[model samples]
Target: MKKVLIISSTRNSNLDLSKDIKNYLMDKDELETEVIALEDFELPLYTPTLEEQFKSTESFPKNISKIKDLICSSDVMIWCSPEYNGGISPIVTNTIAWISRATDDWKEGFKDKHCLICTSSGGNGKNFIKGFEMQLKYLGSNVFDRSLIKTKAKNIEEFEFTSVLTDFYKNIFSE
Candidate 1:
């Protein structure tokens, strides 16, 4: 069975959208899926001082290591995040920063992993998509070019995105 991790960065109604996507992904019998919310991971703001301190401690916070291990173990990743201030949310970036530092090879958590990005945002969320894709590519992840976007006016079911998501997953797993 393929292990898939779905990460959601939103804390509001957008979280419902993430759950919906998770349900859809779980419907696939061959995939074992786990959903993680960024809010649940209490990552402190990253700074050079903290980085040095953490290195000296020689042990990362348990949540950081746990999330890093999940990323490392997953075959594919699906991200559902909201755009904030015309960019990716700070929570998402913070999680990435911590996970990158927690592991010896920063890219080890993402390299060669198939990724699918989706969003439910008040705004169009195009900037979030572009910004995250750039980061994922830099991390050497195989991010899908297509994505699902649901604006405030549409609900997940109304958006009718399951087919695209299914196809994306099928294509990636077939590789």
Candidate 2:
């Protein structure tokens, strides 16, 4: 079975959205899905000095290892975050920074993995989706072309959500 990791950058609406996606994928015979909220893991802000300190000790924080292991083991990742000031949230960026520094290969957690980006934002969220797509691609992920956007003013309808996920699943797992 393929491991599918759903990462939510917040404990709020985006986490709820991640759970909803996990629920949708739970019954799929070929997939084993798990959800994680970044808020649940307390990580210090990433900086060159902090990273160097950890590396000097020949280790990273336990939470960093836990998240990195999850990403490295997963075949597919569905990322859910809110747009903050027309860009990706700080937690998402910080998490990636730590993961990159913790791994021998910077892209170890993301390379060749299938990624589907989703957002539950107060804003339109287009900028966040587009920016994150580029970043994921840079890390060597096969990012889905379409994003699932759920803004506070306009929520995602059931049909649209299901259709996008169904298409993404087929495209990723087809024989």
Candidate 3:
């Protein structure tokens, strides 16, 4: 079975949303799913100085190293975050920063992988999806076009959720 890593970028609605996604994917027999909430990790801000320090120590922070292992082992990645300041939240970006820098084993960890971007934010979450989709594609991920987005007044309709997940699942497994 292929492994899928679902990342929740915040402890707020995004976490709840990620859990929902995990529950949905867990039922699939062809795939195994795991959820990681950023709130559960003890990660420091990534910086050039931090990278140098980690290089000297020959190790990343415990949680970041663990996350790196998960990301490298997984066959697919699902990101659930809020739109912060018309872009992705700092937690998501920071986690990616750490993952990208804190590794030599999987330097291009995301290359040719499949990524699905979803958001449960107060706003429409369009900017986040757009920005994150571009970033993931730049990392060589094949991103799904149909995203799951939830606004204050509008929860994801069943049809939209079903359609997106169905297409996303097909896309990941077919690749």
Candidate 4:
């Protein structure tokens, strides 16, 4: 079975969106899915000095290790996050920073992984999509060409949301 990890960057609307997406993904019997809220994890701010300290520490933090393991093992990741001031949320960025520093391969968790970006934002969310796409691509992930955007006046249609996921799933299996 394929291990699919669905991550939400916040506990608010983003989490709701993640859960909704998880349900749609679960409808695929062949996939093994797990959902996580980024706020639930204990992650420290990442820096070169922090990385040095962690590398020299006697033991790695359990929470970071656990989260890293999840990311490493997953075949696909669906990132559901909010856009904050025309960019990706800080929580998601923090998670990525910590994971990159903690992992031996640095980009192992994202390299070649299929990532589907979804957003529940108050704004247009186009900037978040563009920003995250660049970041994910830099991390070596195969980001989905299109993203699902949900906002105040407009919400993603059921068919459109599921169709995005369906196409992403097919893309993964095709590779």
Q: Which has the greatest lDDT?
A: 2
Better lDDT candidate (1, 2)? 2
Expressed as tens digits, the lDDT of each residue in 98-141 for candidate 3 is 88886773346788888899999888999999999999998788
Give the per-residue lDDT of model 2 (tens digit) for 3-95: 999999998999999999999998777999999999899999999998889889977789999988988999999999999999999999999
Say which prediction, candidate 2 or candidate 4, comes out ahead on TM-score.
2
lDDT (10s digit) by residue, model 4, range 43-151: 7776778767877885567888889999999999999888899998888898888888777788999999999999999976999999999999999999999898899
Give the range where candidate 2 is weakest over 10 consecutive residues by summed lDDT. Answer: 166-175
Question: Which is superior by lDDT, 3 or 4?
Answer: 4
lDDT of 1: 0.85
Better of 1 and 3 by TM-score: 3
Error of 1 at 124 (Å): 1.4
Better of 1 and 3 by lDDT: 3
Error of 1 at 109 (Å): 0.7
Q: What C-alpha lDDT do the candidate models reach, one value each?
A: 0.85, 0.93, 0.86, 0.88
Per TM-score, the best of the predicted structures is: 2
Off by over 4 Å in 2: none
